[model samples]
Target: MNYQTFQPHPDLEALIKCYWTLEVPAEPAATKQRILPDGCIEMIFILGDDVKRYTSGEEYILQPRAMLLGQISEPFFVEPTGVVSSFAIRFYPYSFANFTTTPVKDLANRETPIRLLFEEKLAADLEHAIVNAADTQERIRIMDDFFLQRLKEEIVIDSILKSTIDTLLSAGGSATTSSLLKGEVSKRRQLERKFSKQVGLSPKQLGRIIRLQTALKILLNQPDESLTSIAYESQYYDQSHFIKDFREFTGVNPKEFYGNDELALSSLIYT
Candidate 1:
């Protein structure tokens, strides 16, 4: 297995987190791998054999060759059908809304084909360019051009929404919306609506995912750290509360997650 990430062009740095690539040689006994939420959206292109995303036990669908995956609130499973080679763009939670008018909430937990999001011909052309690119650099250039074109002359990101997301991130998702809003409590409803459309998640939901990601990174980097210390550092109320959120997002407790073969793929990405 090989996994790598690249920084985005400076112009797109605010909207895009990074570009990533993953390649894995075929394994005769590949098993379904669980994927946890990471508080971001992604545009993925499968450059090798198809991969299967399990909808339920024994039921799965082949992911689109070029697609946009929305914010995921729960854990999901996927398995490689053969050699795996994929390139993807990870977008900031509040920034994807600048690229399209489609409410981000509509995209949650599902892979929407690029054709459905953009003109069919345009989407097809972009996919063709990516698939035929000579190298990762070429693919990155193609994506940069495509998104930069779609970017509107006036990028209207909500100031409050952006600030709220920033606070959550900087505070490791421990910041509360009420405190962020301060005296303007009436804006809570409006903020919720804005969050739904721009972020594909309620502020609380994204915060929880962000917090879990923090804990996960600690677990990956410091494998020997006790769960209690991790929970405290991550701002959870207690070990039980931390375990509850862990199970909610990852579908497993910290103990089961560490060194689990089924989570090897997820571990790689989180790391």
Candidate 2:
């Protein structure tokens, strides 16, 4: 397996978090992997083998050759049909809406093929260009060009929303909306509505996901840290609260998650 993340072009940094890619050799049998919420939206282009995304405990649907995997509120499972290679663009919570008129909330928890969101001809052409790219750098260039062409001048993002999300991210989900709004109850309510339309999750939900992400990073990168220390560092009320939230998003406790095969792909990508 090979995984790596590429920094977005300078001009696209405000909207995109990063572009990432993965490749895995074909295996005789399939393996299931758990995917946890990471408080971001992604565009995934499957370039090698097909993959199945579980729709129910025993049911699944094939992911598109090019698709947008929306903001997820829960953990889910997916298994590769065989070998896999893909390029993905991870966008900030508030950034995807600037590219599409589709209500961001409407796309939560599922895959929406690019055809459903873009002009058919353009979407098809874009997929072809990316999948046929000669290398990772070429793939990144293909995506950068596609996004530059799709950039909109009329789509406006509110400064308050970015700052609020930034505050939550920097605080690792410890900041409250009231604190973010300085007790301005009206704007606080307004922020929730705007967040739903643009971010696909409420501020409280996004904060929790961000907190969980912080903990997961610590767990992956710092082997010396114990769960108690991670909990405190992540600003959970206590160890149990931290474990509870982690289990809710990852479907496994901290100790069980470490060195877990079900989490192999995610661990590789994140680490």
Deviation from native of the Cα of residue 110 in model 2, angstroms: 0.3
Q: Candidate 2: which stretches are off by over 4 Å? A: none
lDDT (tens digit, per residue) of candidate 1 on 1-271: 7999998888899899999999999999997889889889999999999999999889999999999999999988999999999999999999888887678899999999989888889889999999999999999999888878776455877888988999999999988888878868899999999999999999899999999999999999889899999999999999999999999888888999987888999899888
| Candidate that scores best on lDDT | 1
lDDT of 2 at 11: 80
RMSD of each: 1.0, 1.2
- lDDT: worst 10-residue window of model 1: 148-157
TM-score of each: 0.98, 0.96
Residue 255 displacement in candidate 1 (angstroms): 0.3
Candidate 1 residue-wise lDDT at 254: 93
TM-score of 2: 0.96
- Candidate 2 accuracy as lDDT: 0.90
